[model samples]
Every structure is written in structure tokens, then in C-alpha cells.
Target: MTRPETLQASSKPNYSSPDILRQFYQRLFPFRPLFQWLNHGPTPQPDFQNREFAFVLPGGAYIRYQSFLSADLFKKQCVQMTPERFEIGPQYSINPRDRKQLRKASSFRPVMKELVFDIDMTDYDSIRTCCSKAAICNKCWHFIIMAIKVVDTALREDFGFQHILWVYSGRRGAHAWISDKRAREMDDAKRKALAGYLVLAMSGEQGKKISIKRPLHPHVDRSLKVLNPYFQDEVLAEQDPWQSAEQAERLIRLLPDKDLTAALQKKWDSMPGRSSNQKWADIDAVAEAGHLSTLSAKQLVDVKQDIRLEYTYPRLDAEVSKKLNHLLKSPFVIHPGTGRVCVPIDTRHLDSFDPLGVPTVTALLQEIDEWESKSGNMSDEEKAKVQDWQKTSLKPYVEYFRGYVAGLLKEESKGKRSREEVAIEGLNGMEF
Candidate 1:
């Protein structure tokens, strides 16, 4: 397999090239496993066959309503068109291509899709002092890390969802795809309710006052507990969002009592250079020493908790999670801007995931060439055992995906059998 010319040793990687994209789709992209994941079994089903795919072509044309009968057909289209990226939408009731032929337009609709949540770094712009608008560093990435911890915990412990997949968006954000049968089967109303349950039901903008109930909701309590540790280390220390006196006012406004905020402001005013950590501490110190709080003790406590949540809670793109037909970028697609493959983030080792360290398309191709050269002494049988993805850094991610798909298929098989048993039992109960 000759490598694409774009991966030459001297030249820089150009992911936008159609030839390079073609090679990537033909070689590294994990279409079979992806198909098995969406199809929910080895064989084609409505989950995969009737699914809608939208592609962003190399020339920047966005084409939607594309459907494929099999994994091979999907791969063929990807390799032929060499799209910059493709998006996965819900499985329609009828084949997307045949929708126009249907007598009633209302009959053509999205049925099932994984409930997804998006956490963009842009959402954290006001809270994070490090970077803004599509730029992220390790220090700022803790926000994402904190988000995953809180949201993942809620999805599992609160909602009892079993299979959740988190993927780095190949740039300054991460996406969550919950693949539990119950999750996928939920309608738009249920999706909205679930998303609303997770995301704070308050104004998320900066310099605005955010309030929380006195007795915290169980979900909110758990999220707060999960976020408390990171508040000091991630937000107050690393982000230092209120380091400047001008910025400190944002924090001051959240306090319920005017006298308390004035005292806290006065303290922070004298020491403008105090870090966010110190300023946060000064809230308690000033409130106690000056006796300025008009709020009850519980109200003061709730106010502080609200302040903590304001800075640390996951700022999800709730709109993305509230719709069944909203298309999200496909896993393993190369982000044209970053040249990185959008790999799944293994929650088992969540804290250690380094988005910046993910493999790029050109580098993965180079790995294949290097491995072929290094294995000159190996027998044909030995070399044939390994897939191209196995020869590169992409092996672990693909293997993880394969394993996840296998588990899903097994559960889906069980679900089918259980439903069949119930139906047979109902027939036996019927009188002739």
C-alpha cells in the first residue's frame, strides 16, 4: 500500500487534501466496528441501514439524508467522496433516500438516537482565564475533566445508564454519547427533560446572579460533591478568574446580602493582587468578622454553594442534547482543523486522557509505513494477522470500540430474546 504523497517526510500534513482523506477513509477509519456499534449487531438492521448520515464534502458542501445498506457501502461512499468529515443523525422510520416517495411527510421522522451532550471550551470562556474560543491547554482542560466526572456519575448513578462513550472532539471540547437502549429510545421530550435535569436550570452567563435551592437536589448535591475538589485546584488556583478587581465583582454579585457583598468587596479592594483562592476565602472571613450578612446561616451556605456551582458545574450545550435529529460528528473522523482523529475517551482512565496527544492522520499513516519497513524479517502469515490500525497508535482506540460494540450487541441479543419470549407467552394465553 503506497502512502499518500501528502505524508512525505519533508512536507507538512495537509488533512484537507482529497487524496489524503481518501487514503485515511480507505485505510485507518474504523467503518466495520462503527457499523456494528450503530447497527447493534453484526447483521444490518434499521439502526444502521435506515440511519441518516450527513457529510461535509471536501469542497465545503454539506450533504444530508444519505443512507447506506451495509458497512461496505458506507466505506465505499467515504473513500469515494473523501469528505472532510461526516455526521451521524438518528435512524429514520424509513430509508432516508426513500423519504420523498412516502405519501405522508409526517410519517418520515427520526425514531432512535443516542442521547448526546456537548461540552465546548467556548462555554467556559468567562470562567477560564487561560484560553478562549477553540483554544485549550491542560490547565483549562480540567474543566472538561470536571465536567466528565459530574455528568458521567449522574448518567450512571442517577439515571442508571450502563453504556456511555465520551469522545474528544479533536479540538477544545468533548462529546458524550449514551448508548443504553433506554437512552436511544427516548423521544425529544424525554431528551429535553433529561438534559434539563443535568444542566443547571439558571442563567449561565457571566456577571449574572445564579441561585440554588436551600436543600440541594440529590443530583445537584452529588455534582457539587464531585466538583468540590476541583473548585480549588482547577478553578480558583489554575483559572484565577477573579484575580483582577474588575473581575472580582462578578463573584461579589452572587452573594445574596448587599452588606455581605460590600464587605467582601471592600476586603478585596484593599488587596487587588489577591488570588481567586484568597478572594474566595475572604468571603467567609469578611462575612464572619464584619457580621455583614443579612441572610440566615442556611441561606448564606446556599449562596456559597451556588457560587461554587456557578464556576465549576459543566456548562453543557443543552440544545444538542434536547433533540433527536441533531447530527454530531462521527467518532474517528479526522477534524480538518487539527488533523487529529476524534478518538473515544476511555472513562476507565478518564483523568489521564490528553487530547493534545491524540494521533493525527498523517502520523498514523507514517506509523503503518514504519511498521512495514521494520517487519521485513517477519513471515507473511505473521504480518497478515495484524490489521493496519493495529500497526499504529490507533490500535487501542479501535480495540476499545470493538469491545464496546461487542458488549452492546450481546445486550441487544438478550433484549430481542426477552421480547420474543414475552410475545410467545401472550399467544399461549389467548383462547381459541
Candidate 2:
């Protein structure tokens, strides 16, 4: 994939050369930590060798099915190529080494994959008026936060899976990798089922898009609960859909009582320059004055649903969650347009995770330049410290990912029997 062209000349830096990127990959990239994360858990041998990796070169050329026998090998290849961006395949191929044989095989084997979800801002273009395409601001970012919470809660509580890895998309989206054993073991059918279940809004042409029933499913209900605050603050107050006459008319037409709709329209028209929130409040006051009593329970529910359909419901690229072979951008790869590293997100501090705050390659190179200029010669300890990613803002996120993977390893070890124990059991079973 090509880097986005939305980045203006003044906003982007100039250190996008192959040399600077190669130096970053060789000297400063935390390969060891990344390897530990990918090699998580207690199998006889971790599945990194079986996993498929792909790279996107500077001119948008793509490479796929590239596997490494070990972390050292993977590190070596990355250091050698210094790719513009890279992606990790969701599915593990049965034979990563013999790519041609695997492709030609009649019955393919895709043993496991972390259930991945992709949420892009462009999906919300229908609702959001502030930004479009790859552009984003704080107002639009609230949608991402809502998406994470809704999906995270459903996966953890409803599906009974844990160990989710959330990562920034390096551009205009976010990805969630549910690395729990059960999630990874899910077949294509199960993955499709989950994707279908999560989809409330269907995709199609403009007018025929969504169809939701009354008495929302507990999953959607729970998601709406998570979405309530963001909708009120970001969409209703800030976006002010009611500002558009067409949008306001549509909302008014949804009301069950014709008299109430007319009243709301009149009230809305009188307040020519009022804030969207204020206009909405005036309409609510009219409803409360005995006008709302005319509507049935179903109508009231539909009104609330209409509001959600316009603002809070999760807009997902269903194919991302449904497919096993889909490749997602690897974390820590630099986004060529913005030059920012695709960092891992800590959901506990989701509010604090800002895409703008991520370190760009240019910024890191500048830091290195300053460091080299100040100290012509350095001690071993100083050299090590300079190489450590801990000197940057990305340190805490990497450490958080390391701790999560460490927990998975600890869990895996608990179920494992040592070689000595197995040997003793074998000996005891034999007759003299």
C-alpha cells in the first residue's frame, strides 16, 4: 500500500531516506521485545516460524509469505531491507518455508489466527462532517475510542476471551488483535459468525444501509451504553446534525406523533442560530410537556435507535474480522506519510493515547544527531542507553506489551510438564 498523500509539505519532515530508516531499524528498533511479543505462550516451540510476514517497499511494491526460522533471522532481514511498512498475516500457514507447495496444495491449512478487527475513520464519513478520508482531529478520534471500548467489552465479556492487543494503524485507523488461545483457534466459520454478530449496521448504497430490530440484542445494548457519553458530547453537541435542514427533517419525521414533529420543527425553526445541543434541548422540553405520552413504547425506542444509527454504532470493515489471510500492518513500522511509528495502545489509558504524540522517524533521527554531536565519544553504558527505546515516549507502550506477553508465557508454563518428569514417568512404566 502507498503512503497517504494527505500530509502537507509543511507538516511532514524531510528525513525519509532509506539510509535514515535503515539506521533506525539496525540501531534503535526494539527487535528483541517485538520477537518476545510474537513468540508468546507455552507451545513446544513458538509459532513465529509458521507465521507469514509481508513488506511494502518505498514505491509501493509488495512482498508476502516471508517467514523466518528464528527471531535473529527476522531481525537480520528487517535490518537489511528497511522496508517502508510491513504487515503480519493473521493466519499461520502450515508450511511457511515452501510457499509454492503450500499455494498449490489442494487442502490448505490455516491453523490459528488472532481475531483481528480494523476500524477506520473513513467508515464514519457518512456521519462525521469535521473530517474526511485519511484526515483526523480530536473530534473524530472519539469514534475510535468508542469503537475500541465496544469491541473490547463484547470480546472479553460475551465471548469469554482475553489477551487483546490494540495497535494504531499508523494512519487513520486502529486494529485489535485478540491473541487469546480460543480466539486464535477459531476456524473461518466461527470468525464469520463473530463478525456477523458484531455488525449492527450493514454496508450498501446510501439509503439502504442499516436495518436494526427493536429490543436491541444485549451485545448492541451494551455497546450503546459504552457509546452514550461519546454520542452526547461529540456527535449531538459538537457535530450538530440538526443544523442541516435535511438531517433535522429526517429526525423529526421519525417521531410517532405528527403534532409533536410539527411542534419540534417550529421550535427548531425559531432558534435560527442556537447551538445544536440547545435546539435539541428545546425539542426535548416540548416532548416532556405531555407530547411524548402520545407515542408508544416502540416509537420511543425507535427514536433512540435513530439517534444511535446516526452517531454511536460501531462502523467496522467486516471483511477484516471475517478473513483469516488478511494482513494487518505490523506495530512499530514507520508510516511513510506522517513518519510516525505504529505504536501499541494501552486500553487502560485509552484516553491518553494520542496518535499525534507518537514519535516520528525524523524526530528520533534529530535526537540521535543531537546526542552524537554533544558526545563525540561515549562509554559502553552510554551507548547502550542511547540504543534503548526507553529514552523515547514509545517505551511505556512497548513495556506494557512485554508484560502482557509475559503473562501469556506464565500461563503456558503452568500447563507444561518438564522433560525430567516425563522421563521419570516413562521409566516407572517399564518392567524390569
Candidate 3:
């Protein structure tokens, strides 16, 4: 019989060096805190015990149905295997390892997982002018910043969900994991409904006009308010998306009145290289000068408001959030492409969160070596006092993550019923 451990994927990214990966799994990874977060307590429970974990092995092999009884065992396997990365999936009704032994295949199915959102930079490529494709810069990062702020505000205030954690995807985007008991309990249908409510309906080509209807929903109104400040500076000033004539035409197409657009287009055509802010100002300037005859003041206000939303609103990839069993990359894993550790974004100090500044596995490992060299003569007693992870730049991120997980567990304890209790109540309603 072929050993399951020997199974390998035909293709996978092998970015992290084997020795470094082994050390990471051994010393750096916070297995206990992660286990506590998933398990919702210090001791083992169905949340962690029956949860599905899929690993991408270093030899380009993929493995699934991986579960552990405790954090230590999970860490032991990771260190032994030294897989490139692993993904977290929904908790099953039965232990994933034991699913095949069941009499009925249908008896084993996914039950619950954190509701997740994936916001990638590629989604904003059409609107952002600073960087496109796979490249990301601090300037272009404002798009992600805008997306996070808008989505986070809506999730908390509008939907009444707390315990939301925003994590950098380690390359050009971000992911949001909502661990609220209410959020975790949502079925695929409810999840889809919530995602639909969050996602803006801006379909078709880039230049196509977004059909923003009258009398916006309270959520839309509130989101527009959240996005208002960013649109002018981050979008209009920094991006200057409508500076070119071709792009300017795309802008003109979105405007309401023919007289207003004609006047603006002529003005833009005559004076080349006009900045987006100046062009925006020119709209009010021309309208005040009586260029717009047919469009009402009330209608114009509505149009401008819609334009703000069209430009700056969060463009969510709704598919990610509309499922119960979908697997998402675990929060703390190293991104294969960038080699950066996925770190939690502290919403309090959001403006200071820089993706490029995130510590890479290599860099973190080096920091450990440098610290060990400095403390070579320290007594064994003193050396054993502090965890090895605290010695590197990854310290702050891990500390922040552990703290976030603590808050979630505390809230989990306060809830009326445990995760399993609540899940068991509505078993028939949920799709596995």
C-alpha cells in the first residue's frame, strides 16, 4: 500500500526553504493560540478536532482530510511534513479522518466555518492607475485600505457582527474572517444573502455606467459616507484616473446631462492634461455657470453621490463569502509568492498598516539567528524564559493575533450555547 505521507501534488509552489519551513513549524508558528481560536477554548472540541485542514507539501503534493486531536499534534505533523502551506476548511459533522469508515457517505459533511471575504488587488485594476496586475505599491494600497474600511464598517455597524479579523493576504490584497457565533452559524443560503447585500452590482465593462438607483438603502448611504473622504484624495488626487482623454470620455459617459457632459468634454479636449480634482471641480464650475439646463439641482446631487459610490465602494468577490464548506488559507501562513507572513491588520492603527513592511519567513528566521548570537552567553534558565518567536520582528504580529484570538474566545464563552450546540439545533436547515 502507498503511504499517504508519500502522496504528492503534480504542481505546487515550493517558496519556503525546507530547513526554514521545518524551523517555522517547530518554533515560530503559534499552534496553541491558533488551536484555541479555532477550538474556542484551551481544551479540544469539535471546532478543531473535526475541522478539515489541507496541506500543500514541499514536494508539490496535496493532502486533505488532515485533522488533529490537539495543537501539539498538529504542530508535530507540520514539523515532520514541512508542507509549503495549509488551508483551513469547515468543521465536519464527523472527524474528517473517520468519515470514510461511516456506513453512509452522506452522513459525513461540512457543518460550520468562519464566514470569509477575499478582496484582491486584481479586482481594482480597472479603477486604480498606480499599479496593476500582480504588482502592489503603497499608493495603490489605498484601494485595499478603502475596501477594508468600507467593508469592516458595514460588517460591524450594519450587520451587527463583532469579532471580525482583517488579515493581509501577504501579496496584493486582504481577507476578512468573521468569527462571531452568528456569522459562523450562517448556512450557504444566508451566507450568499449577506454577501449579496455587501457586494455592489457594478457589472459589464470598465467604462459602462453603474446603475445606482434612487433613495439608497441605509447600508449604501452609510457605506458612501464611510467612503466619501477616500474618494477625493486617494482616488481623484492620487489615482487621477480620468486624466487621459480616453479615460475622460469614460467619465463623461457616466454623467447625466448631455449639455453638462458636452461642455465638460469640450473643456477637457481643449485643455489637455487636466487633473481629476480640477476636472471634478469643473463639473460644479460649469453647472454654476448655467451649462446644465435640463438636470435639476436635486438630480445632480444624486448623480454626483452615485459617482462617488461607483468609484470608491468596496468591490467584493462575493463567491468567496457565499459558501459554507469553502477552504480559505489559514491566517498566519507564509504567502508562497511574496514570502511575507500573513499578519492581522489592527483596525485601530489601520493607516500605519503597510503590507511591504510585513516580516518574511527568511527575515524572521534571520532575526532569530541575530538574537541568538547576541544572547549566546546567557544562562539556559534565562534563555528558556522567553518564547523563540518573541525574539523576531514577527513578535508584534503574533502578539496581535494572539490578542485577537483571545477576544474571540472570550466572546464565544459569553454566548448562550456552544458552537456545536447551536449547530446541532438547526442541522436540517444548513447545507453541508
Where does candidate 3 have its weakest 10-residue lDDT segment? 1-10
> Best-fitting candidate, measured by TM-score?
1
Off by over 4 Å in 1: 1-12, 202-206, 427-432
Give candidate 3 regions above 4 Å deviation.
1-14, 416-432
C-alpha RMSD by candidate, in order: 4.3, 4.1, 7.6
With candidate 1 superimposed using the best TM-score fit, by how many Å does residue 253's alpha carbon deviate from the native? 1.6
How many clashing residue pairs appear in each of the predictions shown? 0, 0, 3
The lDDT leader among the candidates is 1
Candidate 2: tens digits of C-alpha lDDT, residues 1-432 = 112235678856644567867877876677766665666642313367678889887767898878876777887898788788788884454646575665367555567777899999999886776778888777778788888888889999999877888989877889998877778788888899999988775433233324467677888777777787887898887667667766676566545577677787887677666666776676567767756657764665566565665577778888988877778888788888788878889999997777767788777767766666666587767776665465555567778877878876675455454656888999999999
Ranking of candidates on TM-score, top first: 1, 3, 2
After superposition, candidate 2 runs with Cα above 4 Å error = 1-6, 14-16, 41-46, 90-93, 102-104, 202-211, 253-259, 288-294, 371-378, 417-432
Query: For residue 404, what is the lDDT in candidate 2?
Result: 79
Angstrom error at residue 374, model 1: 0.8
Error of 1 at 340 (Å): 0.9
Over the stretch 237-313, how does candidate 3's per-residue lDDT look in tens digits?
88898999887877787887989999998898899989999999999999888888788878888888878887788
